[model samples]
Target: MSDTKSAVGYTRLSQTSDASIPDQKREIRNLADREGFALLNIYDDGQRSSGFDAERPEYLEMQAELETGEVDVLVVRDRDRLSRDKRERSMFYYDLDEWDVELWTTTDGRVEFTDDESWLIEMIRNYMDDVTKRREIQKAKKKVQERVDNGYWQGRPPFGFRLDSDKRYLEPDPGKFDTALTVLQMRENGATWSEIEDETGVSAGTISRILDNEERYLSHVE
Candidate 1:
């Protein structure tokens, strides 16, 4: 085992990010200095989630180098920065162990492969991270369902509707309601989507959807 080795840092900022990539990199750099490792390169996965996505471009590139025994040290701000999934994290650890590469972290310092406590701590953290992601996703789905039940559009409004003044609910566009109705009536009278589009100047896709008024319209309203 070498006393000093070439190191590369990996960092991630999620899609719903708070611009923490710089802070993560700074911590990794500090760790490199404290450990006397040569900080050779840094990789970032910006606006990407470690929980949902299996592939991150820069992270994979780093893994390729790690596989070839090029990076003697792999540093991260935290273990979850590598992956929220325990399986992926284990795969990375396996590769590092196979290559005799050392793992370093700003939070945990240098890892000792024989330390069972360190391994358990990592497993717990990864489990917690995954749980948090699942909870967040469930919460978001519930919120969207609530909005839909309350007659508020959860996402962008259709062509014949616009957001209310508060932007919390979709209201029928007074200017476009008649056009939507016309499309529906024409379709009912055996008009093709393109024919309806040509007649009403609305796109064929929107016209097709408008024909399914229940999907794109609020009940008890035009």
Candidate 2:
């Protein structure tokens, strides 16, 4: 059997301008080769946010591999590629310890968890990343709310309404307004969600939103 250690790479991209997945992969592969590790696979979470709550399919898959205890090393371009949330990163570090997997990064080289000083440095880094992510989220929400305050629609219009000529406000769609009205009437007449869905082809979820925000939909038609 070959003496080379087995390694697997992971990459994640949250934005278009961030380091490309290909670039991260190349960096991980180069690092693995230079360190005499035999790279077994490279997992990617394309366009997936590093938020703690975000459901990353590839990240989960990589974790499952780690649980098998066959992977000797986990490679990434940087620690942030693993997670931006400090709490989440700490939990992951614990799991890596349990699985006996070494984490190698192109920027930081091998991560050493052997000392309090090293742990402090990692804690500081994770804290900074979490702050930056939260600020970006706040900025994005502010921009979206500003647009809504300016009488502009923030996202896709509801089922029965379309954006007006300028695409700034919601207007009743002539083709679907009657259907919307029918759905509301049916629900008010004690029609079940499944019955309405069967009659109008509008999903129960969409029908719920339409009923919940009935005033907003009615405002356009009135």
Candidate 2, lDDT over the whole model: 0.88
TM-score of each: 0.67, 0.68
Residue 221, candidate 2: Cα error in Å is 14
lDDT of each: 0.79, 0.88
For model 1 the local lDDT of residue 18 reads: 38
lDDT at 48, model 1: 56
lDDT by residue (1-222, candidate 1, tens digit) is: 776789999988875553388888899888889878899999988765554565989888988888887778999887778887767877778678898888888987877676788777766766778788778879989998987888776777777788889878777888687788788778779988878888999997787677666555646263
- The candidate maximizing TM-score is 2
Report the C-alpha lDDT of model 2 over 1-222, residue by residue, as the tens digit: 877889999998887867998999999999998999999999988775655654688889999999999989999998888988889888898899889999999988999988899888888888999988899989999999998899899799888888998989888888688888989999999999999999999988889888998888777665
Candidate 1's displacement at residue 118, Å, is: 3.1
Note the clash tally of each candidate: 0, 0
Question: Which segments of candidate 1 are over 4 A away from where they belong?
Answer: 1-3, 17-19, 156-165, 170-222
Clashing pairs in model 1, backbone N/Cα/C closer than 3 A: none
